[model samples]
Each structure stands twice: as C-alpha cells, then as structure tokens.
Target: MIGRLNHVAIAVPDLDAACAQYRGALGAVVGAPQDEPDHGVTVVFVELPNTKIEFLYPLGDNSPITGFLEKNPAGGIHHICYEVDDIMAARDRLQAEGARVLGSGEPKIGAHGKLVLFLHPKDFNGCLIELEEA
Candidate 1:
C-alpha cells in the first residue's frame, strides 16, 4: 500500500528566503518552485538522499498553510508524504482499515506531479499523512 517516504513538507512564510537558506546553509539543491493553485500553496523541493524536503507557503489567506503557520508561529512540519503505486486502491484499503480522509475520496494533483490524498492526523498517530501515487 505504501512505497516510500517521498518528502516531508514544512510550512514557511517566505518561500524564496527559505529556499535560499536551505541552499546556502545546507548545500541543498532546490528544485524549481511550483504553485499548486488548487491546494492554494506554492512549494519548493530540496532533493535529499532518502527523501526530499518541501517548503510550503500559502497563496492566499484562505490557504490551509496560512492557518498552519499561524498556529505554529515559527512554521513546522506540514505532513509526511508516502509514495504509493495505486492511489485508489490505497484509499480503499486505508478507509477499510478505518483511516479518516481529509478531502473527497479522490486523489488530487500534488507536488512533483503526483496524485495525492491526505489522511487525517487523528488516524495516523498525530502526523498528517499524505499518500502520493506517481
């Protein structure tokens, strides 16, 4: 049902500055920033050995990331994404196993050109879970 840890997303207030800091301080090569309008956030990816790190920022006030940053202040981990082979199957399996989904029972276009769905944190030991199908 799960393939690998794709990336750990972190919410940030300024996307460019965050990318610069990661590149300058950690020598991380940042990928091109992507704006996911449907999700109301822009993201920059930093490729790593095992998994990538995604920096997220709200596109507008209604964006969910905005609320996240508000509560976290210094910003924090948004969610952990796990790559999956089949999103529909995975959703069914998770639902049967009693996992709570955050949106409609359908995968949406997510970062890195993957189909993604989020499982409520309450169902995943306090961690917001993202299932991505490449």
Candidate 2:
C-alpha cells in the first residue's frame, strides 16, 4: 500500500525563523513558502538528499496548524507522509484493514500537486499519517 516516505511535516509557530534555521544555520536548500489553502497551511520544503522536511505554519485563523500550535506552543512533528502507487487502492486496503481515513475519504491536491489523503493519528500510534500518490 504505502511506498517510500514522502516527507515529514513539522508545525512551527514562526515560519521565518524555522526557514532561517534550516537555510542559514543548517545550510539546507529551502524552498519558497507555498500556501495550501485546502490544507490551511503555508509550507516551506527543505530539500535533502533522500527526503524532504516540510515546515507548516497556519495560513488563517481557522487553519489546522493554528490549533496544533495552540496545543503545542513550541510546535512539533505534525505528520509523516508516505507515497502510494495508487491512492484509491491504498485507501481501500487501509480501510478494509480497519484504519480510519480523515476528511471525506477522497484525495486532495497536496503541496507537490499530487493526490493526498490523511489518516487518523490514533490508528497510527499517535502520529498522523499522510498518503500521497506517487
């Protein structure tokens, strides 16, 4: 079902500081901030040799990241996204195995412009999981 680990998302209260840390201090190649209205987040991708690290910040008052930041003031790992050859098939198989899919059980355009779906954190050991089409 799941393929390679796509990216690990981290929620941060200060997007600029986070990006500066990665770009200036760590000397990482940081991508520009992209607003994902559907996901209610402004993301910056830090490129790496193998995978990417996504920094997520609230885009609006109702943004999900806002709530996450409220609970975790210092911010933390929000989710781990994994690639899937076929998103629908992966969703079906996961559902059949008694896993709960978040939202409408339909794929949404992700930051990479690929179909993505989120799974319940409770089912995945308190870590939110995102499935993105490969």
Candidate 3:
C-alpha cells in the first residue's frame, strides 16, 4: 500500500532556471541533479517540508518527457509519486482494483536511486500516479 506522498514531479523546459525559480520563490535548494539515460531525462530535486519537488526536462527529442511537454505546453505537474513499503504488493493490489500499469513488470531504478513504477493515467482518473520504494 501507499505510505506517504514522496514527491510531486513537474515538467519544465529548463532545469537551471526552474531550480533558480524554486530557490528564489520558496527557498528550496537543489539537492542533486541526476541524469536518467533510460528514461531520457535529467532531473533536479528540491527538498521540501515533508516531501520534495522534482523538476524534469527531456535529455533529447526522443525522450518521453519531451512528448509530455509537447502535449502540455505549460509544463505542469507530471506525476505524484507516493512512497510504498512493498512495490510489488502495492502494484498487485492496484491491478486487482482495475488500475493499469505503464510498464510490463517490476519496479525500475529512478531518480535518487529509488525503485519506481508508474500507474497509467487512465486508471487514476487522468492523474499520473507513481509508486516508489524508499
């Protein structure tokens, strides 16, 4: 089952500018920037009160994040990631409840060395859901 709200991921065009904006506006500091070659994204994490905010930008045109930004030009919230105790169990429960998963099987390595998996937006009422084990 879901444990806590881990982080909210926001898609941005520029990572540095977005990090600066968050730092100036909310006093958030960039924890670390990670490059995920498989996902084709470079992510910067800004630590918040109990959770964190993730800024994502595509590494190239073929990136999935690029297509996402193209569809949502404003580059808004991409997904809400929730911390989970057992990823496989949580995924199974979700599937049993009629939620569709984006990937075929198993959680994969995500930003900050966390195991992550995504639930299809259609199954979550148009909100992209991410399950992460920390």
- Kindly list the per-residue Cα lDDT of model 3 for residues 49-92, writing each as its tens digit: 79888889998657879888889887989999989998888888
**Predicted candidate 1 versus true structure: per-residue lDDT over 55-77, tens digit per residue:** 99898658989889889988899
Model 1 lowest lDDT segment of ten = 105-114
- Give all candidates' CA lDDT scores: 0.88, 0.93, 0.85
* Candidate 2, run of 10 with poorest lDDT: 59-68
Candidate 2 per-residue lDDT over residues 28-130, each given as its tens digit: 9999999988778899999999999999999976898888898999999999999999999999999999999999999988878999999999999998999
Q: What residue runs in model 2 are displaced by over 4 Å at the alpha carbon?
A: none
Q: Judged by lDDT, which candidate is best?
A: 2
For candidate 1, report its TM-score.
0.92
Off by over 4 Å in 1: none
| Of 1 and 2, the candidate ranking higher by lDDT | 2
What's the residue-level lDDT of 22 in candidate 3?
A: 86
Error of 2 at 58 (Å): 0.5
Give all TM-scores, in the order shown: 0.92, 0.95, 0.91
